[model samples]
Target: MSQVSEKAVSFEPEEKKEKKEWKINVFAMLLVLLVIAAVITHILPAGKYEQIEKNGYTTVDPNSFKWIASTPLGFFDTVKSIPTGMVEAANIIFFILIIGGFFGVLKASGTVEALVSTMAKKLANREKLMIPIIMLFFALGGSLMGMAEEALVYVPLFIPLALAVGFDTITGTAMVLVGASVGFTTAIMNPFTVGLAQGIAGLPMYSGMGFRLVLFVVIYVIAVTFVYRHAMKVKRDPASGIYGKFDTNEQDSLLTAKVELTKRHKWILTAFLINYIILVFGVIKYEWYIKEIAALFIILTIIIAILGKISLDDTVESFTQGSASLIGGALIIGVSRAILVVLNQGHIIDPLLYQVSEEMKHVSPFLSVVGMYNFQVAIHFILASGSGHAMLTMPIMAPLADLLDITRQTAVLSFSFADGIGNIIFPTGGTLMAGLAIAGISWTRWARWILPLILIEYSIGLIAVIIAHLIGYGPS
Candidate 1:
């Protein structure tokens, strides 16, 4: 057996063996997409839609689409778009960096470790219950506040707890990801998606809460159940877990460690909870966006450092280290945004939107609404931002719904469902990619593991769209 093992190892150099298992870097893949988008600009006809501003929102005039001179991106223009994309996405990129830094300070304070250790001890035997409880909390956050990027802050905390409880990293990820995504999809009060789409569609803000609330329950239950089943499987056989056979020494230490929350740790955690409360309040009352949230986290990081008695130099170093670790993931966001720049520069986005709207108009009302949902899903591959997607597409979908005898509220619902659901699986989604990067999971592995759940969610979305159309789900 030893001779055979030696022969097998000697058959290939270690570097060659590593090369055989290569995976595409997320940033590189997105850069290639940028090039592809630029190439398509030359292939597709260029067009523009007239825009009108209403109540501080700019929306497209569906009837105003017209062919325009194609200005496909030159090589220099294509290259320049990378920096422009970074600039355009700077708000979100910085938000991610600040979150990383905040979490770093929090981690350095021993708050994360103590909390995980405490949770692991309490839920050691009742591990299965953690799935639903944790998922429900995240789902509520997503449903209420549109918590996509914010969810990344929890991945590091949960992964250790998940492993401690006989689950794997993917389960921990899904606890946050699948939960938030489902809530975002149901979107009972998600201002980023449902609210923006409703406003653009000219419906009363949050008019269809009853319908969406029902969806929230149904979809949330489905998501929690799916994640629970997977966790159970992983618990029974570690090899069955996605990413396979993780080292359990750290997880075992978390469970066995006699970790007690010191006075400082407790105070730090209290401040942490208060920070989130402030965030939700600010978002709801003050209409806080990325900038406000980033500022909040900056303050919280300082507070955490102070409460933990971390030195000034140590705090700065921790913050810098944390931010540096996430730079790769954050840059992926910039690169993904570059694809949108290329399409816009090529002037093909409007033409694609116009083509879909025209195609939907020719179908039956049922098919047309379903087609709208599917179109939103497909479009999400390129346009991943929730509010941005709504602002661009809802203007046309709302009017097209009227022309097809479908309700504007239904159009808004289709948009929310597609946009939220697509966030989990789409490659162009910077938040999802960044979250995966934080968890140290490759996008391909995550995609493979989550694909089944996505199919189920997409089916739910399809059925919901159909029911909305059939029942004339409309403004209250």
Candidate 2:
């Protein structure tokens, strides 16, 4: 799902703003691990477990672990794994590509810009509700559709609105960044995170949704409340805003420009809304996965391009350029998969799961659950792609959850919580980086303002994990 995000993302900042530069390159760090894992294969004992596939997801047979001859990966194999992992991760990689392409077509049509303009006009005076309302919209989008990179497109759009509302660039950025994060961290039906994790964990699609929906509301409240307080403070004192390199003269011109929605824009937006309705229906009723979801976007892309009367060449170019933008995210998915590739090829995955299961047995189930959450947070910091993270971890975590006397649902919850919360907070997260870049905000500055909210979001995840355990969350 990720290579596409890296490729399809194309944001033109209003102007280059000089600001503090922070360097913690996640890609270089993640790729280096491929070699590290290959080296570890020579030291970690080789073992295997029988795996059975059910409904298109793989589950390891916990009873079938057996020691195997070591097959350590040489340096050459580690280098070769880049392409191999991408090919293995094609399902999600392509899904992200098509989604990126689709959004490219949509953005090129100027509907998103038009919508942002409309929102700014209506919300100019209702500044107090902007945080709660705007953030709530983004939070709902995240829980419902696993929105992350999609939120980046709105970052530039919101900056002017924030300034117009007498707030800062950070406030505007937070509306798009943290707004979606609340629902993401407390996922309800996010196909990318909870859905993929749960499916691999061998639980029903969207099971235990009742508790998740509740968690979604609570987390959304916290997120909006946090952002609201900051927004209002900035509104009261323009000097209080963290504009970084943000210049009032340059940004003010953007807000002052007229953005009247035309009849064509109305038709285009209607088509977009209908497409989402179809998307939700297909996912819920037809049990659509990556291929189906990607196909839906392809169809919508065609419809939008035609209605917008964009030339075939322009449409293809836009789609291609957008798809190209997300290539990094897509490649990262494959490269990250290479780490698991080394572990799996060396037959050490089962032993690792076994060791983790043994460790959990020494602790309370609650502690085990928290450990799962924390481990996922650590993993998500490195592997930002939700589906890629799921493919890497769920095989081991599912059976480990079974062994720990905890429901797979709880394990999925932990994965969802960890996976979602880290996206905005971590420097490695492509979406977070992209959003900060688009808003012209520094990571250090964004972290200072959002760290407290991150802790609160983490607590919500912890509470949800604990509640899932106490409720014995599963039909499996």
Q: Highest lDDT: which candidate?
A: 1
lDDT of 2 at 263: 82
Q: State in Å the error of residue 399, model 1.
A: 0.9
Residue 425 in model 2: shift from native, Å? 4.5
CA lDDT of each candidate? 0.83, 0.72
Per-candidate TM equals 0.93, 0.77
Per-residue lDDT of candidate 1, residues 291-387 (tens digit) = 9989989999999998999999989987887787678778888888899999998998999999999998788998898889999999988889998
Question: Which regions in candidate 2 have their CA more than 4 angstroms from the true location?
Answer: 1-16, 91-110, 141-181, 188-211, 233-247, 316-334, 364-369, 379-412, 422-451, 463-476
Each candidate's number of clashing pairs is: 0, 18
240, model 2: CA deviation in Å? 6.8
* Superposed model 1: Cα runs more than 4 Å off: 1-23, 243-246
Clashing pairs in 1: none
For model 2, what is the C-alpha lDDT against the true structure?
Answer: 0.72
